[model samples]
Target: MTRRYCSLPRQSVPAFTPGLAAERLGALIGGRRMWVNGTVLHYCFLEADTDASVIPVPGTGETRRVPWAGAREQLDVVRECFREWQDLGIGVTFAEVSDRCEAELRIGFQLGDGSWSEVGRDALSVGAGERTMNLGWDLTEPGGRWTALHEIGHALGMRHEHQSPFAGVHWDDEAVYADLAGPPNHWSRDRTDASVLRKLDPAEANGSVWDPQSVMQFPFGPGLILEPEQYHNGLYPPGSLSPADKEFVLRWYPPADVPAPLVPFRSAPLGLGPGEQADFTVAPLETRVYRVGTFGESDCVVVVFEERGGEPRYLAGHDDGGTPHNTGLRVRLVKGRRYFVRVRLHSTWGSGETAVMCW
Candidate 1:
């Protein structure tokens, strides 16, 4: 039987789930790395020399430093993907940087390394001067666009749609293991389990209905999923961002600029629904440690950014982060310095129940 190499894009979840994701945690420019709406994140490409050519071996606790093997002819594909995502009109902005030391995303293209990316805020934790993303194959191929989009989605905090708890996919484990063990993938049983067979924690799932065409899904050929019988033949996404993908991101990262008017010491109501955010600008009168906190019963994350040269610089972060406690953080403020507090709610008990205050 002729194997399909196209299905073997070899795309993995970069470290927040596996590794580049983990890489992001240390590489963060500022001490904090929360995805506050309207924040600007920069990405840089790895060139020859230093750790630019290093690839961390996933699950083996090892790494390899070798010459870059990327298909330079299609070099601009990643940037193109970022542009397409920006065209979606989300609040967060993406920029390219020449220095890896100053970038939130350090990408590499070592041949045979397989395509993967850092997931979300973890990009901040990536070791300084290390690569947090990689692409092994040429992005000019048929599935290349989707691969880039999918990996970027991960970097932006989107998890695998197939791993969604709402997705009722029951896999025929043996068939999946056999298929992935062959050409292009050669994944071991453990690797296959971690990538395809494993299910995500329900808490991590974004709680949306499974959109089969989500670009953040793995292309499982026919006869892999035994349950959800509709997918028994195969579950191949259309190789593009789905409507849900755009909607999900848009809800979390709105297009309109969030103002900083809800001043310090004044409790302001967060007039947002699920997946909505509020930005509060604070102008400190004196240098001191201050506390910002959310009141009443609500689930949210709070990120603080200092305005530096017209850009928001990360300062600190705190969150309910899936626990019962409301989010709060204590950050030092410099006299006359302007700062912004971004609060995003995952869910709230009632319309007027959630509010935040800084003092």
Candidate 2:
């Protein structure tokens, strides 16, 4: 059976024995929080003094940064991808064409040796010199679009397909470790375990059909797994998103037929002071959970109120009793209603950073 593995280009090869190479790869790939097998994502918190709470553009006052010389053209590709996904019934909005961070999703490519991105709401935690998404290659390269879509997939909360609990692949562990440790991949045993062998929880399958051709899948040659015939040496190339991929995305982010009742908040770390209040209108959804959280020592409280006939009625309130040490609350919301989320710092602790979102 043939097995496919992630190999480094010959020109980038390092001087090291197979065992040593394997150890290094394992450390680099497995030792951090990741969106996929090899993609590393970091946690960045909003600064204590920032007025806005949603992930802000790295610099102050709407100024933005670009990754490279052709960043403008590259952004077109990203915007088009968002449009494609939206056309397929996904709920996503891309900013108007420009060379800056005027949208919810901002990615700046800096000098780097690899690609990485934060998953979903984690993008809010991005820091300076760090991006929600980062790329080492230029958009003109052969795998540029594939790389963008792949990282964006992570941004959308998708994980590696190989790790799906439903994917019934059997790895030839010995061969996989040997190949990755020897050349381009030079992955350590633990790295190999996390990337190629670890399985996601069964609940993550989301009832969709399993697809080996997913863009999230990594190429593995023969002998890496027990059933070579069943698993193609290179199951799927990194070109277009597979049919299952489309279905999966749509399922998670279906089309929104109604305009949002209020403008979605984009500022990071909505720093609420004592008794401070913020109002947000919840748009229609079949069902949704709203999460409110804090970053510092301030004890935060949340109260959900629904406006009926122009009068406010309290629905629920969360105090320090909730899990995660009383710094957050999870509230379920109904459709097509204007709900106000009042957030404030509890007594004793005067002020701190807070965040609110729904999914």
Against the true structure, what is each candidate's TM-score?
Answer: 0.79, 0.53
lDDT of 1 by residue, 167-282 (tens): 98898999989998987877788777766677766545544588788888877778889989988987777879888999878866778575867566889988776556788888
lDDT of each: 0.73, 0.50
Model 2 spans with C-alpha error above 4 angstroms:
1-73, 96-104, 110-112, 182-186, 206-208, 257-359
Runs off by more than 4 Å, candidate 1: 1-34, 52-64, 67-74, 227-230, 271-274, 322-326, 335-337, 347-354
Highest TM-score scorer = 1
RMSD of 1: 7.1
Candidate 2 per-residue lDDT over residues 171-290, each given as its tens digit: 778887887776444578877776677775554442345567776777676667675466635455556688888877664454533322333334335554432334455553555776
